[model samples]
Target chain A: MDLDLDAATLDFRGEVRGWLAEHVPRPGLPSMDTAEGFAAHREWEATLARARLSVVTWPREYTGREASLVQWLVFEEEYYAAGAPGRVSQNGIFMLAPTLFAHGTAEQRDRILPAMARGEQVWAQAWSEPEAGSDIAALRSRAERTDGGWLLSGQKTWSSRAAFADRAFGLFRSDPSSSRHHGLTYFMIDLRADGVTVRPIPQLDGEPGFAEIFLDEVFVPDADVIGEPGNGWRVAMTTANNERGLSLRSPGRFLAAADRLVDLWRQRGEPEWAAERVADAWIGARAYQLYTYGTATRLAEGGQLGPESSVNKLYWSHLDLGLHETALDLLGADGELAGPWTDGYLFALAGPIYGGTDQIQRNTIAERLLGLPREAR
Target chain B: MRFTPSPEQRQFAASLHDLLSGADTPGAVRAWAEGRPEPGLKLWRDLADLGVTALRVPEECDGLGAGLTDLVIAFEVLGYHAVPGPLAESVAVAPALLGDGERLRALAAGRLLATVALPPHVPYALDADVAGLVLLVENGAVYRGEPETEPVRSVDAARRLFRVAGTGGALGATDGSAFEAGVLAVAAELLGAGQRLLDEAAAYARQRHQYGRPIGSYQALKHLLADVVTRLELARPLVHGAAVTATARDVSAAKAAAGEAAYLAARAALQVHGAIGYTAEHHLGLWLTRVRALTGAWGGGAYHRARVLAGA
Candidate 1:
């Protein structure tokens, strides 16, 4: 019946706050707008790694401190409060790392886990081929049988971070004709293969966080396959479920930014409309936090991912985009003058498109959760 | 963290469902409200007998001492049975007027059936006449008043509304949190009504046929039903969250979220029922009527949205 954290959890939060205050890098450490920012953030992560606080939910065997879920949430709250770097290797560590621990073979785990834990290896996703983004089972990449191995040949577009990745985890169709999500295998392929090519795609913000990867006759040893061949569908489903399940972005980040926006507007003594917009933005930010906090509490209690996560994702995306849009709007004509607000607004447009589109999430909720019949596309 | 209702709550909800379904169909409700003429005595007695009117009063005052969660169960049952009365308003708004032991005892005994006498445009004003007094709230102030007009007919045929001319005792200056609580209560009722509509629509679609197949088996109608279910799912958490927050005295965000959930539920219910729902013969229309009344009952969805947008 009560919504407040427990006394012990509150104490834990205070401890985290005090620790973060002492350890967080000083302002001007880096920004998120450029490669230098990304590198600087990596350095910050390495520092946290040294302190054994990064990724608190990972087991102690994985070089983690094995904190409780509540402590994990508290850590995140403090981490975001302290302006820690956004985890650049989230696709690798947050999504794949967990799955590798659970379903991966001993060899696979031995090869992947430590490098991921240490941030020594950067991983990219090869899940979404151009034709296979939403209908992921329809992946066209082929991995044919070869002497003591498999030869891979195909293309994966929107392969996030492929340009900077050392390796990739991908689902490939083992039998070229087995298209309805069967006879496929999940493989870990080295990005430095002789015939591989990675080309960065300029996004709306002209950032190259996205890349198109071409796999041309790349050989992967049989040992690299994580599970039974044809079990790729299951493996990929597990991966996606983990990906969506673990995606936890709180409103604190946006709230911090929005607070800064408000301070800027207020300090400048701008229009009264700007005050109203700031208030509106704050409301949206707080609403999102409440929803996310609810989700976090659920996960802390060992709850599985459900339709409601879509609700959270859908809500936060819309709220984040809305607040940023408001920020841009409040800046008026000057808001479109290529400043922070304008760039943020453009970035917000990608919110609905990334992870999964809002429409797609609704469809998932409808078809999978609500048991709705699929719409003929 | 747990989202499921408790066993006791479930049991009480089941009992309520049985009582309400057996005793308070739409026709029966309308007939009773219109036939009773003992200055609200019969209605009050009936509510007490059903334990409906005594839910929120403290146990020390001969009441059930139940909070918003229990009230929510009662409301869902009431909505399901189309119980036409001030079940929500009396329980939600009466406590605001109970200043001393005498007033508290009267409310606990169901001698008082209070309604929030918000204006015609206010959505939850439909249950006004059953109350001995109507509490009106505006801009975080409370003004207890009498109705300026008789109860106006509502689409649900379960309740009526009236306009209050803004003249009554100042119910003491304090934050209008109670009124906000009432609004959140209406949102809970709306959640129930929306869920009922969704369930009914789903059942009907499963039985109703088109081209020799159940309409629900068709993609178009299935997705429509799914959309309604999604709205129901989304609204459920918001309503529950609001009730939790309301008990904790955190009203602003919950109120806003509840308002949106109720408003969306109403709209989605109407869309699901299509033309049949627009007609009065079907109960879907009745729920829609209730939804419209509830959506505006507090401060209207727009006001709550604005409040929410203003960062409660």
Candidate 2:
């Protein structure tokens, strides 16, 4: 009911805002949609990591300031408000951190958490196979049991950042005889190992952030297996939940975009009607902020992941796309051809497809959230 | 940094839910909205007692002064209930009219009812013989008017609309601010109506079995329902944010954005509900009518869009 931040939180916002004003990266870096852009993004993350300002939500034990979730959100808002590149290693900060904290052994956590926090390593998700995108449980990547280790073999497509990643966390079929969901095992495998091949996929935007990985007899020590054997689905679910639920976009970023868009709309000799669309976009952005706050609140309250997280994914992806679309619409022909808006528009299209498609998110909502009966074959 | 409602807000919202759950029942809302003789006195009085009628009014004015955020919560509940009344305008818009203490007190007491009239459609608008005041904007001047007609039947059977003939006693407030707030109020109300339609469709999707399973499970219905929910979520925040920032150093952006969100939510809601949603006997059509009325109720989305563009 109350949207106003308290005095302390507001003060925290001011501090974060002040920090971002100085540290935002320069303009000559690679564009975010391109491979070079991701490299630049990583460099920016390393710079922030050096300052100990990146990924504020994790505990201080892991090189984080151990800031509260509210402060973390403020950090994001301020960071985005400053036009800084998004965290380059989000697969590390947002996804892997939570997964390792929950399931990794203490020694594993000690080894990975600090290094990941300091940007010493980059992680890619090796989940989706050529045939198993939505039905992730049907993964055919094999991990054979061995003395004190496991041997991994098979391919993982849509392996974001795998082309340059130091390591990957993947799910593999460890037992050929077990059921589809039960035979899976989760492992953190070094991408530099022998017999690992990574080839980047060329996207429309010419980004090589996504790659396909072919593993032939790659070895992973049993110590790197996350959780128990056959527990990969549960661990991967935890990762996916973090991917969908806890990840967020700062409202200030969109607000800043709206500010620029309003300027762009008027500069083109357009009428004031575009301002309303901008305002609508602002509303969508603000709503997304509120939605993220709700998710964070649940996490603070120790709530478990539920179907409502799908609602969050479904809602925000469309919101992100809609705001950019409105920006493009306002720009008319100019928006379609050039500038940040065009790139944003293209990137936004992937919002629904990545993480989970809007269709799949809705299915989750229907079957799980609403408890509707499953579709009859 | 956090944008969601707090625990306290949730509790306050629950109060609204509890009160409006009965007041906004589909039947009652339809009865009054179509200008049927139902006054909805019981629900109104209950709301007044619960401090909803005076939520946005300043405490110095013998009201709660909970501000727009509180009003957002109240109206969202009202929308959820689909209570066919000018509750948002009466509470959010009337305070700006500078009406006499008696009128404000009556409004706060749930004994008085008020609604704002813009252009293009005027029903039994001047018929305030049974109510405390009628707020109308004419020739760009906001006037407190009195009408001689009774509440008349309309496409939306749950709301009462009156047609005013002449401007009554001037309440002395000529500022366009109140009028703009009234428009935004309608927008917020429409946001609520859209949500109601979405809920109806979702519920129906769960119960309406097809091919031996809930229709919601089918791709066709799933996509439709998902689209409706997406639109609803998109619009809900816009409306709420507009309310939050309406008193901003600049208000046009919020109003314009809210105007679009309102219309879009209602439109998508109707689309999701399909045929049964269009019937007069059902609450879906009632929401559709309210949305239609509210779409152009004030300056409208097009006009507001222009305003926003001008601001930009």
Candidate 3:
């Protein structure tokens, strides 16, 4: 019920505001999918790592500030408000870090987290295969038990960040006899290992934002296995929730976009019929910001992250798309030209498709949150 | 900072739910729509005994003197039950305007029912004939209004609207806090109404069969209802947040979101219920039409959005 921040949170917010104001790059960074931009974005992550801002919620030993979730949210708000560069280590920092903290061993955390925080080991996700888009449990990737580790052999399409990321993580079929979410093992695999081939795919924006990771027999050490071997389904479920939840997409990003959209509307002479849409963007963003604060508070109160995460995913993805579309509508004829607005609009298209498609997220909300009848697959 | 409801707030809402659940609210609403205010007024008296109408009245006025958050908590439950009356007017607007007086105490004690017409924002006095007091707000001035006029039928049959005319000198000066409180109060009602619609739609989907299976098992209807729940869930926090902050910017944002979310719920519920929901005899129409009425009651989406644009 209380919305006022404590003194410590306010102080932490002031510190983050000052740091972001001074260090955030002017003119912003290029797309992290490109080679030069990837290197530049990686350097930016290293700079943030030195300041312990790269992973604000991680342990201090891993270059994090040991910040509470509220402070982490404040950091994100300031980070986006300052127009900071995209996180080059987001795959590991946002997605895998939480899973590792929850399911990986202490040794795995000590070994992997510090490097990830420092941007020394960038990671991509190898979840969706050509045949296993939304129904990710249908993945055909197999892992055979070897002398010291497991040998992975499968093709993973839409492997985000694999175009330049150092390592990737995915679920693997380990028992050979089981299928469909059974006997699967979660593994962190090196992209540069022998028999691994990364074929970069140009997105609609003509950037290698994602790739296809083909593996003949990529070796992953036993230390890389997350949770129990057969319980990979359970472990991967956590990652799915994280991917679709507040970790991957906080309301800060949308709030920032909303501010930018409002500015755009003013700059464009406030076109008719666009006022409602533009204002709607602001409304949706504020609603989302408040919604996430509630979510963070619930999580802090020891609430479990469940299918409610899909609610966040479903809400923001549509909001993001609508915001960008509003920006384009404000641009009018210039909207057709390939520019930042167009680039953002194209990127927002992925919002509905990735991190579990909106349709899939909606189904999760209906069945899990509302206790509706499950779809007869 | 925390945005979740407190234990007391949760308990208050639960008690309201308990009382309203047994109040036979549908029958009361039907009576009120037919100009028989006895059933609805009886429920109002019971709610007042529970201190529902006294949430915003100051302590000196013999009331609880609670904050806007508490008012919204009460209003939300009232909307969930589809309670018929000048609820926002009596509980929120009246208390905010005519503070620390016998009128306020009377409202707090449920001895009086009131309605107001604030020009531009609220041009019509809702349920004016049944009200013990009808007021007009114009140019920061509050005046007594004549309410025994021709009735203007509202979208929701239970809401009796009258074009109230200002008849006397200013009773007092207002800083327009009443309108702001009314905005947030109406937003909470819209959110609750939408939530009820979503819940009913979900329940219907669970039982209503189509093609040898529950219609909820169909992806098309399921996805439609799912989107409705997402919007309503996100909108819920906005109303709660605005209630806590009570800022003009936050209030507008809350109203805009709740209005749109409620309309979406109404549409999705009607689509799910098909022809049955379209019938006035069905209870779903109460929530559905109440949502439609409340979305534009205090400040329409466009007006609120303009406020948001101005503040943003």
Winner on TM-score between 1 and 2 is 2
Write down the lDDT of every candidate, Cα atoms only: 0.66, 0.69, 0.90
Interface RMSD of each: 4.6, 3.5, 1.0
The best candidate in terms of DockQ: 3
Put down candidate 2 lDDT per residue, B253-295, tens digits, no spaces.
4444444555565665566567767776666776677767656
Model 1 per-residue lDDT tens digits across residues B27-95: 555464474535334434765777877787778878788877677666766666555667566776667
TM-score of chain B of each: 0.82, 0.84, 0.98
In order of lDDT, best first, we have: 3, 2, 1
* DockQ, each predicted model: 0.27, 0.40, 0.85
Ranking by TM-score: 3, 2, 1
Most TM-score-accurate candidate? 3
Which 10-residue window of candidate 3 chain A scores lowest in summed lDDT?
A368-377
